[model samples]
Structures are given as structure tokens and as C-alpha cells.
Target: MTEAAAPRTPGSPCWVSLLVHGMGTTQDFYADLFGWEFVPGPDQLGPYVRALIGGKEVAGIGQLPPDRHLQVAWTTYLASDDVDLTAEAVRSCGGTVAVGPLDAGESGEAGRMAIAADPGGAVFGIWEAAAHLGTALAGAPGTPVWNELVTRETSTVCKFYQTVFGYEAEAEVSADFDYQTLRLDGRPVASLHGVGHALPRDRGPHWMTYFEVADTDEAARRVVELGGQVLHPPRDGASGRVATVADPEGAAFAIVRSTTAG
Candidate 1:
């Protein structure tokens, strides 16, 4: 397992959590796939659970509110120094706050969090950590390796994130495809890509989280065996062998076997 550490920069993809049904089943699937262990969140946090890798926090899973009707999916949270200011920035840049500039815990042990969407309609979160500073492990088997914004509105989405997070375009992987790398402090932290003609049609703009796996083909195969669907067959990419998959409950995410392990 790679050493886990909290994100240090403002624009970093600090943490990710999934809101899904059948908490135990969802947890079991991921635990089997990624070797993650789940621990219940603080009592006041309500139905929240943390996913850990090698005793280090990696992700979170929580139950959906009984009254809400939303699809199950992973939501990435970007590190922020101030969630209120970031929420305002999201609004000023053409995004909407879907929920909270509220405390994540009774005494704010988790942090202040707010769910917001970019102009292109991708949902994400802003977190100002208090006792919890987000994911503690990365770049290892079952740990998050990358995050990408897969959207047709690449330009608009890119500009909105730039304004809100001080992100800069570092490289363009495909001019015709409108695929670009977004950098924070000159480091490639996430990617932005236009929807390809051959890619699956997403309902709208959204961020796709990628986790590292020991073997892409094996992981994809297990996803099917576990009753999840393989959306993209294992294939070579600029970074590594990759596959797109959806959990049984229909939350889609990607898995990668990095060309060069970090």
C-alpha cells in the first residue's frame, strides 16, 4: 500500500464519497474489489462510512436520504481553504450549490462541505477539513490514481474550474478532441476531455474518478462477476490499461493499471 497523505493544495481532488443504496452490499462490492475496509462515521454524521486502505482513509460511502431520488455515483471533493468562499465562486462562475456550506460533523470533525456543480452540470464538492483532511492514500492498488472531467462542454467547464480553483491548462492531449490537462501548481492534477463519438453517452457533464488496480483485465472481469457492468473493455490509454465500469447499483467509475506505478 502506498503511504496515505492528505491533499495539500487548494485545487487538489482531496476526497471522494459515494451516495448509494444497500450500504452493506455497496461496501462489500468495493471491499472485495479494492481491499478497502469500512468504518462507521461519527454518530452525528448519520449513515456515513469511510473506506480505508492499509488503515488509511481513501474514500467514503453514505446512504441516500429516503426522500431524495438521485442516481448512485461517486462525488469528488476538491480541497478548499474556505467552503463558503468557494461556493460563492462556484455561483459567480455559473455553477450552482446543490447542498451545504454546512458543517460535516456536530463539532465539525469532518469539515465544512458543500456540493456544487460547474456550468456544464458536473457535480462536485468543496471541503475545508477540520479533523479529517480527506483521502490518506493514493497511487496504489485500490487507491485513486486520477480524476477527469468527461464533458462535451470542455471549454466552458474548463473555464469555470479555472476561475473557481485557479487551475491552468498545462497540456493538450488532443486538439481535435478538446482533451486537455488541468494543472495546479504546475502539476497535472486532473484532466478535461470532450465527449468522444465512441464513448458512452453520459446524461450531462460529470467528473469520472479513476482508481489504480493491479490488473485492468482482472478487475473488469471481477466487476462483471460481482454483477456490475463493464462499460468499457480493458484497453490501452495514454496513462495505462484502463476500463470503465458501473457498480451493481449503477455508479460508474474507472480502473487503471498505471504504466508506471507511483
Candidate 2:
């Protein structure tokens, strides 16, 4: 486990959040699966709550607006020194800023944020922290371990992020596979995978958030028992034993017992 007390580096994956239709049910499912406790968070977006483990913030869950029908998926927020500048950079790099570079809290103290999509339509967020620093704790079981962008190809999107966030892309040297590890200050922070035709038709290009678990198989089973579905059974991957699962609301995420976790 790790405590992120200081401000996160720019371009690093700093926070992950989920917007769902039923806030209470979604909270109950996650709390049961991850042993998380709920605390009220900034409500400017909607009914929102921060998930805590051992009194430290790990993630956020918010209730979606009733009239707006959107996917119930987890969003990975990248840290930015200046959100407005980052939003403009996204626009200049052929991406679209769908939401604001606006204040999040009632008194404009929580932080500034903007929702954006890449050239390939992969949605993400940019955050400039004030009082609310992104994710406070991670690397342990029930905390975010990784964020990956699964898209059709890595070359174009990798260049897009590199241009916008100054990320250094280190790609795998293989003709059969396409993947890139985005680095900031020489540390691997996020990754991009080119899956081509394997990309799900229903859900286009999007970011995938992985949460650490003590036992990947047990976590997969627990997901099934808690009114959720195991989309992919636990299996060995480059990182560790992992499984893809979806909440009752059909928002998909991965649980892994990462080999690199201390």
C-alpha cells in the first residue's frame, strides 16, 4: 500500500471515478467487494461520494443526472498542472473537450476538472487539484493499481497524448502486438494497447481501470456473488493474475493481484 500525500505529477494517472444510475446500490456493491467506506465528496457534479480505505481516499462514485443517459464506466483522470491549458492542448491535438475546465466544489476549492475525448473517442478527464488531491491511497488490495487505454491502435493516440501531456512513449518491440507504456519523469504511469478488431463494438475506445486484490480468483467469485458478472475469469497476464468483471449496472473493470505490488 502507498499513500499519495503530495501532488501527483502531471500526465500521471491520479484518480479513477465511476458514474452510475443507482448511487446507493453501486456504493454497496463496491464497499462489499473492496471493503471501502463512504464519505461525502464534492457535489457540484451530482450526488458524489469518495471511497475510503483506512480513512484514505481511494476512488470516487457519483450519481448520474437522470435525464442524461451515459455509460456507467470508470473514468481515469490524469493529473495536470493547469487544467485549462491542458484542455486547450487537448483541443489543439485533435481531441474534444466535452465538459468544462470549471471548479468542482461549491466555493471553487475542491479543484478544477474537464472531461475530454481523444481523436479516437476515448474519454478521460484532466484534474488540477486544490483541496482535493486525486487518489490519496493506492497499490494495496482494493486500491487502483493501473490505468490502460484500450484502443484500435496505439501509434496515433500515443502521439496525441505525448503531444498534449509530454508523455514519453515506450512501445513494445513486436510486429504481432502493439502496446505502449506512457511514462512521466522516467516512471511508467499509464499504458496504451492497440487491440484492432478485438475492440468491443458496444463500447468503443475507452480507458480501463484495474484495482488490486489479494486473490484474483476469489475476487472474481465475489463479484459474481454480489449481483455482478465475471466478464473474464481470472487468468495470468503480463502484470499478474487478473479478471475482468462488471457491476450490476454493467460497468466493467478489472481486479488483479499485481506482481509488482509490495
- The best candidate by TM-score is 2
Q: Supply every candidate's count of residue pairs whose N, Cα or C atoms clash at under 3 angstroms.
A: 2, 0
Model 1 gets an lDDT of: 0.86
- lDDT (tens digit, per residue) of candidate 2 on 135-200: 898788999989999999999999999999999999999998999999998999999999999999
The lDDT per prediction is 0.86, 0.94
Against the true structure, candidate 2 reaches a TM-score of 0.98
Q: Encode model 1's per-residue lDDT on 92-143: one tens digit a residue.
A: 8899999889888777877898999888778898999888888888788988
How many clashing pairs does model 1 include?
Answer: 2
